[model samples]
Target: MNFDLNTEQKMLKDSARNFFSREADKEFIREMENDEKGYSQKMWKKMARLGWMGLLVPEKYNGEEMGFLDMTVLLEEMGYACLPGPFFSTAVLSVITLLESANEKQKKRLLPKIADGSQIITLGWIEESGTYSGKGISAKAELKDDNYIISGTKLFVPDANTADKIIVAARTDNSPEDPDEGISLFVVDLKGDLKGDLKGDTNNKSINIEALKTIRSDKLCEVTFKNTIVPKDNMLGEPGKGWETLNKVLLKAAVAKCAEMSGGAKRVLEMVVEYAKMRHQFGRPIGSFQAIQTGAAC
Candidate 1:
C-alpha cells in the first residue's frame, strides 16, 4: 500500500500545523494548563466547524468518515503544539468507544452532538484504588424494573468537569464466584445526574467530580458516583463485555501516548540543535563539536 499522504491529507496536515502555530502558542498553552477547564470552547467550536471532530466518525452520522492514519497525523501536530484540550478524551476515547461498542440508537443520538461540538463525552473507569486494570469496582448497577441503579465511585476520570456524557463501566452481575465476568459499559448523563463540586461530574449527590493535575495539566479529574441511577438502554453492547472494550481503548490510548512522547522528543532535539547553532564555544558554534553532533543524532 502507498504510505504517502494524498493531496487532501497533506492539506489538512499543513492547515493544522499552521493553526497550531498561531492559536496554540506557548503562552496560550501555559494559560490553558493552569485553568480549571483544560480546554477552550472557542477552539473546540472552531475544530467542530472545521469537521476535525468528525474525522473518525462515519459519514452517515454527520462525520467526515476519515481513517485512523489521518487522525494520527493530526494527533502528531496536536502533540507537537502541546494543544491544551480534550481531543484525545473526546475524540479518541469517547467517540472511538461509542463507535466500537455503542448501538445504532446511541450513535445516532450522541455522535451528532459530538461532531458539532455541542457535547463532550469521557470514559469513567477508575476507582479509589486507582487501578486501571478494572479492579476493586465498588460501582454496581443493579437491574431494577428496567433501569440500572448505579452506586459507587470512579476516581481520576479524565475531563469529568466539562464532560456532557460519561461512558461508565460497572458491575452488573455480582457473582462472587467470578468477579471479572459481570462488567458492563453505560453512557450516563454525567453533567446532569453525575455532577458534583471539586471539578467533578455536574451532579453533587449522584456523581462528584474533582479536578486533578497531570504533568501536562490538560484537565484530568477524578469523579465519584454515589447511588447514581442509570438507564439500561444507556448500556453499550451486551452486559459483561466491558473488559474487551477497555482493552481496545487502552491500546489506542497507549499508542497515542507514545506518539505524543515521540513528538516531544523531536521538539527537544530541534530546540537543542537551534540552541547549539547560536551558542559558540571556543571559536565556532557548539554544534561543530563531535560530542554535540553525536548527541543531536541520538
Candidate 2:
C-alpha cells in the first residue's frame, strides 16, 4: 500500500489546518459551547462559501463529489480544532444516509440545501435503550393514509436544538422475533406544527429539545416527539429495514470519528513533545530529564 496522502489531499489537510488554527481558537470553541445553537451560523456560512460543507456531495447537487477519503481529511481537521455544532450531524451522518438510501427526487430536493449549508439536518436513533442496535430502537411510527405519525424519545441526539430538520428512526411494525423489522427512517421538519417558529425561541409550544450536559461538551441533545407527523415522501429508505440501514450508517460514523480522533491525538502528541522540550525544571529542560523523556517516549 502507498500509505501516503495524494498531493490534493495533502493540500486540503494543510489548508484545513491553517483555517481552523486561525478561526477556531480556544476562545471560539468555548464560546460555541454556550451558544444556544451550539455553533455560529456565521462560521457555517463561511465554511459553505469555502465549499467545505459540500466536499463529498455530488457536483450535480452543488457539491464537490470528492468521496469519503477526502471528507475524512476535512473531518480530521474539524476534530483537531475541536469544532463545535451540527457539522457532524448535518454533514456526516445525515448526508451519508441520504446518499445511501434517498431516491433521486429526494436527493435533488434535499442535497442542494445541505451542500450549500442553507439547511441543518440530524439523525435520531438512540433511545432509552442506549444501544446503537435494533434492540435499542423502541420509537413507534404508524402509517396513516399518505403520512406517518411518529412518536418516540431519542436520547443523546446531536445538535437537535439548532437543526432545521431531523431524520428519525421509527418502528412501523412490531415483531418480537425480528427486532430489526418494522424500523423506518423519516425526515421530520422542525418547522411543522410549531406554535411560534422553528427556532424554538418564541416560547416554544410543542418542540422538545433538551441538552444533555456531559464532560465532553459536544452539544448532545434529547428530542421527544409526540404524535409528530411526517410525510411519506420524507421516508429515506425502505420501511422495515431501517435498523440495517442505520447500522451501516453508524459504522461509517464510527470510522469518521476514528479519523478525527487520530488527528486530535496527533496534535496532542505534538503539543506534549513541544512542552517537554521547552519547559525547564531543576536547571535543565524537562525533556532532558529521564522521567519526562520516558513519558514523552511512551
Candidate 3:
C-alpha cells in the first residue's frame, strides 16, 4: 500500500490544521467546555459549510466520500485544537454505523441532514452492564403495528443529550446464546426529547446537556431510555446484524481516537521542545544538560 499522502490529501490536512488553529482556539474550547452542549453552533456551521461534517458520507448524500485516512487527519487537527464537540459521536460513530447498515431510503433521508449539520446523531449501544463488548444488549425492540417499542437504559451514551437523532441498538429476537446476534439498529428522533432536556442554553435553548467529568473534558453522559417508540422503517438492515455494524463504527472511532491521542502526544513534544529552548538553570539551558536531554528522549 502507498504510505505517502498524495497532494490532495496533504492539502486537506494542511487546510484542516489551519482552520482548527484559527477558529478552535483555547478560549473557544474553554467556552465550549463550560457550555451545556460542550460545542459551538457557529463552529458546527462553519465545519458544515466547509464540508468537514460530510467527510465520511457518500457523494450522493452531499458528502465528499473520502476514506478514513483523510478523516484521521481532520480528527488529529481537532484534537490538537482541543475541540469540544460530538464530532466523533455524531460524525464518526453514528454516521458510519448508519451508512454501513441502513437501507437506501434510510441513507437518503438521514445522511443529508447529517451532512448539512442540521442534525446531530449518536449511537446508543452501551447498556447498564458498563461494557463495550457489544454482546450484552438488554434493550428490547418489540415490533407492533409498523413500529417498535424500545425499552432499556443506556449508560455513558456519548453526547446523547445534544443529538438530533439517535441510532440505538436493541434486541429484536435473540437468545443469550447469541452473543452479538439478534441485535438490530434503530434510528429515533430525539429532536423533541433532546430539546426538552437542554431547555435554556444559548442557541440550543431548549436542550438540557450535562458533561460528565473525566480527564478528557469531553465526557460521555449516562442515558436512560423509557419505552421509546421508533418507526419500523428506521430499523437498520436485517435483524441480528447490529453487531457487524457496530463493529465497523467502533473500529473507525478507535482510529479517530488514536489520531487524537497522537496529536496530543505531538503537542506535548512541542511544548517540551519549547521549554528546552527557553528554560534554563545554572547559567545554561536545561536542554543542554545531558540528563535532561536523555529524559526528554525517553
Residue 55 alpha-carbon offset, candidate 3, angstroms: 1.0
Best by TM-score: 2
Model 2, range 41-98, lDDT digits (tens) per residue? 8889988887887787899999988979988998998888888888889989998888
Cα lDDT of model 1 by residue, 1-298, tens digit: 8989888889888998899898888889889888788788998999899888888999999999998778887887787887877788888888888988999988998898789998888998878777777556658888887677788777778788888878888998777455556889988786664333112333436777778767777676777767777667888998987868887888887887776666666777889999999998798999999999998997
**What is the alpha-carbon lDDT of model 2 when measured against the actual structure?**
0.83
Stretches of candidate 2 off by over 4 Å are: 193-206
Per-residue lDDT tens digits for candidate 3, residues 240-283, read: 78888888878878888999878878878888988997998899
Residue 82 of model 2: what lDDT? 84
**Best of the two (1, 2) by lDDT:** 2
Candidate lDDT values, in order: 0.81, 0.83, 0.79
- Report the error of model 1 at residue 276, Å: 1.6
* Cα-based RMSD of candidate 1: 3.7
Residue 195 of candidate 1: its Cα lDDT? 35
